[model samples]
Target: MKSLNHRTKVVILTAVMFVLLVAVYACGILISEEAVTGSFLNAKRPPCLEHPFGTDALGRDLFLRTLKGLSVSITVGLVASLISAVIAVLVGIAAANGSKWVDALINWIIDLVMSVPHTILIILISFALGRGLKGLLMGIAATHWCSLARLIRGEVLQLRSQQYVAVSRKLGKSSGWILTNHLLPHLVPQFFVGLILMFPHAILHEASISFLGFGLPPEQPAIGIILSESMRYLSTGMWWIAVLPGLTLVLIVLLIDKFGDHLRMILDPYSAQE
Candidate 1:
């Protein structure tokens, strides 16, 4: 380990974090409904050895419930980020490869989307789409692609000016062939890093919209819904109800962000050399 390069060490660390994150998500998914079922006898208990996160007003174990909520949030984030990344890649390629007029039009659309406040826009979109899982997914996916699309577009333009690309064009390679053989391969790093970074934003937005009552339904076990319901109990000194779960969400986001940053460092040629 002492002989390892900085990039190698980062890769090892990132792998460990990735495993840890996967475990958390898996744990949440594996938890059963029975684990979080409520009973009046156990209601409103403060944190204890038996129930680490304590019980809520309905007597459900906050720990299990929180895990379940986190699982839901992670699922939403994964799906939304994937869709956004696809959109970003396609739009980016189009803007970079198409006519000047086409590029201008795409840029204008990106700017228009970015100009809106994300939370407000998500809320409006969610409401319009009927305010459930589908609505939230669409809203988050739609709003999160602008910056990444711009990055891909710029990268494609730069790649187009490269000697190898010009040589490929001279060899009579079709545009689609060049895109698949050259452009897309070079874009793998940017695509993955962008996707990872988008996750935190997606998760946060999902929580935010849900908390505002415009994302998921009340019946679903979501962090946003958990936080929203905890409001009334906070006045009664049930601080643990919201605090622990919220902290968990923050910690997960920070972990994911750290993983993305380290992975980016390892993948970047210049940074890896250092």
Candidate 2:
């Protein structure tokens, strides 16, 4: 039967992504420093059958490094987005269920976070945290959770207004039990949608921060760092290394973001119709 749920189709796309990322990551690990360093005196070769994506100034294989970049971007996006989603769910539920002051405080902090320019705020936070992987992860995660918090808060609010919630209150159900049984189920769809939406932001933020030199180090196989390295080589006519990887990164981000939209459609058919 033709399915209305879209699970099979979505699962296919997810599997494709999972396979692509894992393959690239495995390639990154097995690639020797010798291959990337181009000790064979073949640095800066243009794209050809032997060096499909071309070679960088240092003689590194662009295809390998590009895959490495993809791996790093995917890893960063996953880590930061997951952390943000968890924090958002916890904080949003707290605000939704807590007393007046608690709700106000949560909203107020969310507001404060939203007021700043996100990339700049991330940089400042990363700088303050000593500007490494930890700093970059913390910065990306910290800058990107308000929308998730709002989503969770709205879900919780809807749950609170439901008839079952009132009955639970009258039936001597503890707040914890009510939250676990009734509210948590409703929260899942919202959480999933919020997670997909957060992913692109996480990736773009990581790339931008790294481009500015506050994120992943230059020697690492990060997209932003690759692009940064290409800037110096561009005038000399070796543009494929940076440009191709960058285009690949953009395509990957767009694919994931569109996939997220598809997921939201799956979870909220009414929203899709609208």
Candidate 3:
């Protein structure tokens, strides 16, 4: 009965996660038409039945704009996290299987990258790349891989010492063959968890950079941009302008992070057994 309960819980969590992901991805499509058009006459309206999340200074529907921004953020997070995950997997494999000198060099690189503050490094990278969507994506993809790489490297190193792996080495299998056939399969769980874990970080960083005016342009209705724009109206009692969007962003990030945790729990053999 306990086992059945566990399975049911896992299934429910999986369904919830799937629905959340689909909703996030489809937010742009669902809200794009309304978000693109605004009316000055309806401007600065408070949250009500007609404008559930209120209207911006330009009379744009805050709810639609928020949804659109979240959709963009989710897209950026998905792409950046996938890129970071791939880079981590490749670097991790190289670090684990390469010569001692190569391993040392990769380890040093990882340490150097991780030693710096992520926000500072990301800002510098984004600035250097000219501060737009491209720069933001690059900054996020480049900075978020070190921890995942280290995790993968450690996992691969441990897998390499296993009896089955040793037997494969003795069977005249090439290094590439052993990696593809043995190491890669074993690293799937770590890779997936790491990838999902990176998503919230990517989204938050993207919003931060945009808020600081170093990410997506002002024309883009990103959460950061929304919050930044809302600053001018705060003294006039337009609190919902900032509060609603900011809370929504936080809620999305929390959901993604929780999803990652749940996924990790479901995928971990020990956790499943427990």
Identify the candidate with maximal lDDT. Answer: 1
**Distance (Å) between predicted and true CA of 256, model 1?**
0.6
Better of 1 and 2 by lDDT: 1
- Model 2 misplaced stretches (Cα beyond 4 Å): 1-34, 269-274
Preferred candidate (TM-score higher): 2 or 3: 3
List clashing residue pairs in candidate 1.
Answer: none
| Candidate no. 3 TM-score | 0.96
Worst 10 residues of 2 by lDDT: 1-10
| Model 1, C-alpha of 9: deviation from truth (Å) | 1.5
Return whichever of 1 and 2 wins on TM-score.
1
What tens digits encode model 1's per-residue C-alpha lDDT throughout 127-233?
99999999999999999999999999999999999999999999999999999999999998999999999999999999989998999999898999999999999
- The true-versus-predicted C-alpha distance at residue 273 of model 1, in Å, is 2.8
The Cα error of candidate 1 at residue 52, in Å, is 0.9
Measured by TM-score, how close is model 2 to the native structure?
0.90
The TM-score, computed over Cα atoms with residue i paired to residue i, of candidate 1 is 0.98
